[model samples]
Target chain A: MAKGIISWIDRRFPLTAIIKHELTEYPTPRNLSYWWNFGFLAGFVLVLQILTGIFLAMHYKPDASMAFDSLQTIMRDVNYGWLLRYLHSTGASAFFIVIYVHMARTLYYGSYRAPRELLWWTGQVLLLSIMASAFMGYLLPWGQMSYWGAGVITNLFGATPFIGEAVVLWLRGDFAVGDATLTRFFALHYLFPFLVAGMVVIHLVSLHTVKSSNPSGINLEDKDNIPFHPYYTSKDGFGLGVYLIIFCWFVFFAPNTFIEAVNNNPANPLVTPPHIVPEWYFLPFYAILRSIPDLLGGVVAMVMSLLLFAVLPFADRSTIPGGARYRPIYRVTFFLFIADIFVLGYLGAQAPTGYVVPMGQVATFLYFATFFILPIVSKREDKWLRARLPQELLAQFDRTNALAKGQNKGDAP
Target chain B: MSDSKSMDKPLDCPERRNFLEKATAVVGGVGVAGASWPFINSMNPSADVLENAISEVDLKVIEVGQSQTVSWEGKPVFVVHRTPAQIAAMQASKGGPDPQEDTARTQQPEWLVVVGLCTHLGCVPTRDNEGWLCPCHGSRYDNSGRILHGPAPANLPVPPYKIVSSETIIIGVA
Candidate 1:
């Protein structure tokens, strides 16, 4: 009887086949590490954000006058509103954490090379779209930080020529940040997640198109592959367990760790805060913005800093397909680049006066130089590597068969 | 490489076919534009949005030299009952930066009204003895809200206001 019903449904839709193809029977590389599970963790965070955000939106009032009070009401009055709000808020910070790790893993593994270029670009767009959604969502509370933060960001557009003033007025819907801005931001906040969800779909679609890149950075044969159902699905389940432990720690114990104390105060336009910094995730880009004294130039530099990731596939001229894993020189440069961003991010939170400005400029210079000069350095290094160890490259490119790799003399280790 | 199909219709030249294709595209474009009109129009200010679109301020209780701020459409509207000296000083001043007479800025000689934002970067300016001083970049506006000095390129904008009675004025409506 169950078989008959299953066949009836299967005739209409290839449910069993789809499950086998996409989930239960999907082939994945055998040597994937703990880092690979972050893709699933990011997806989990997205779902968490959407779920908590939907509930919070049901109670959120977008008026600047009432938004602050509404947040209090949600905390003090609504049933489980505090839980939903914290989940959504902390989920935002958690979202960035997972995504940053995911992107860094992509860079470290050279997943953006050649065939996965489109996949990587889609991810870059997804990152940008998610960043925009998070930025807009931050204003829903109508806190002092939210008000001035939104103002400074919108004011950045005033650097554009000709229709700058008109565009600014149109965005704010008033001469200054007020109810209209709040309402519009709320509407966009409600709208952007769905847009991001669409981008996520595209991102996943592009990812599935090329299949996943592995840490080994080599194409695995059927023998080196495992069905995703019993293997990766179990690994992913375990990863989710660890993620939830960390997530629940924040949700239960340290809910307000990522939130600022000043954000408790209502938005007041008459008084500008002592320091106007964006959320921690945006600090590096914010540093880039303040690094240049010229307004338009600053805007351009900040934009280029983000969009430079798109040029990564073309920028890499290395023959080492094993990514930074095998390339020692590139690996050192990669770590230095990460350190530079951390320094820039720290400088961004500080007042942009005195030594901070010059230091940020130096960091920013190094950040850009990382992408532009990597290809040149890799090309030169490839020559020396070819001279000393030409056999390594040949062995890496032409592995006879995965099952027979144990017998391969070059890979004796 | 030429096909025999072209020989059958000598009048159907490349230009004629191109014109037909272009004309069809233009018509389709117009149809799409027409279809999009309602969605575009719906985004304009609806009735609910227009609720806080105008604000009425009571002017009777405000005495001379006293200023009061009221929120209209989420912007601070400054209503100052000008002192005789300030009004006289404003009228005597021809043009410092923004080329506008005092009469043009005020509905009544005793009452001064303007949006309380700096023209330079949209910071709210603080009122002073002479006029208003922008705390951000130090742009100054005269009693008539004319740009007096600093980085401001234009005068503090006078919002469109309707004085229905001597005791009350409505802002944000022509």
Candidate 2:
């Protein structure tokens, strides 16, 4: 009966063929390290987020009048409601952490380079969809942070000339972030996860088309390729186990780790918090946003920070795809870039005043300077690295050739 | 293999083919748009949410020269009990920025009520020593909610409201 159903379904759809092609028989480079596990972990967290979100929605009230009360009810009244809410909320943070690491991994490996630009772009699209979804979802609680955070963000659009007021009104659906904003945000919040899921499909499809770029940033032949089923399936299963343990550790122990204390109170438009900070994931960009003094210029600077990633493929003019591990200078700059972002994030959490302003401005400047200067720096750095790095490539090449000759078959060399 | 049906020209007549193509496109476009209407409509506040939108507040609790912020239809409605001197200052003002009369913003001379949000953006303006100051921007309002200074192009809007009793007021359903 199982065989008959499988055959029937296989005849109608390419179900088995697709599974075999993309999952079981798919060839993945054997040299993928633990860093590659983040992609699967991100995918895992996305699923978890959607599942928890769906359950939370079943009990959630999107109206500004009841949104905070609804969240309270979910926590206090519903069956394991607190668990689901915490899971979803924590899952959002975890998803960002995983995705950021995944992006960093790709950057370090030069995975955004040639023939994989679409894959990188699709990943960016996925990132944007999730970011939008997260932003909209943040408003559903209708807490002080939800109201004021959204107020600050939407007002940023008011910097636009001519139709700025019209745009702000249209986005809010009224004069302010009140009933209309909450209701619309809820609807869009529900809609965007499905959009993210769809984008994930496109992302994965594009990823499989070009395959993956390994740490060495070099293409590996069939000899270096391993089947997905026994090799990666088992590997990913173990990675997921470790990921879940860490994830559930947060979910069970410190569920409110990510939720702000100000959010516990219902939204009071009159009483602004001393500091209106967004979720930690958005802090870096928020820092950049506040770094500029001009309203329109600040908005532009913040937007450019996000859009800078999109142009990385063209700007970072280097043939070395995964050469960061070998290139000492790029390696140091990459870590420094990471450090700069962390500093910006720290600045974002603080009020934009006094010495924090200057520090944030410098950090923000360095953040963009990393991207703008990477191509020029990498051009010089690549030559220096390559002159010293010929032996590493040769060794990798010899290993691939030996694997092709069946000298290193079915073993971890 | 050589049937007349197969031999017949795919676009038998260009006019009919064009009409058919255009008609299909239009029908498909209308169908898609029609399907999207409900999703768009659902985004607005439901009748149930709007049912309890109106809010009533007791004015007895508010003293002279004091302001109270109340939620009406899930937005902050600022109710200020203006002192005689404060009211005079507002009325005596040689208008600043986008000017509006104090009487227009209030139904009673002493009782001033307007949405607390800044006219420039939706941020709630903080009650200041004078009247109100928008923390997000420098937009200021007098005791009567008139835009006094800054980038605000308009005054704080007064929501539909009415005095229901000697000490009670209802906002939103006026």
Provide interface RMSD per model, one decimal.
Answer: 4.1, 4.0
| Model 2 CAPRI quality | incorrect
Q: Best by DockQ, which number?
A: 2
Measured against the true two-chain complex, the DockQ scores of the candidates, in the order shown, are 0.18, 0.22
List the candidate 2 regions with Cα displacement exceeding 4 Å: A1-9, A386-413, B1-64, B68-115, B118-121, B128-174
Worst 10 residues of 1 chain A by lDDT: A400-409
For model 1, the superposed segments whose C-alpha errors exceed 4 Å read A395-413, B1-18, B33-73, B76-174
* Per-candidate local distance difference test: 0.82, 0.83
User: Over all chains combined, what TM-score does candidate 1 have?
Assistant: 0.80
Give the per-residue lDDT of model 1 (tens digit) for A96-150: 9999999899988888876777888988888898898898889889888888788
Count the clashes in each prediction: 0, 0
Q: Candidate 1 lDDT (Cα, whole model)? A: 0.82
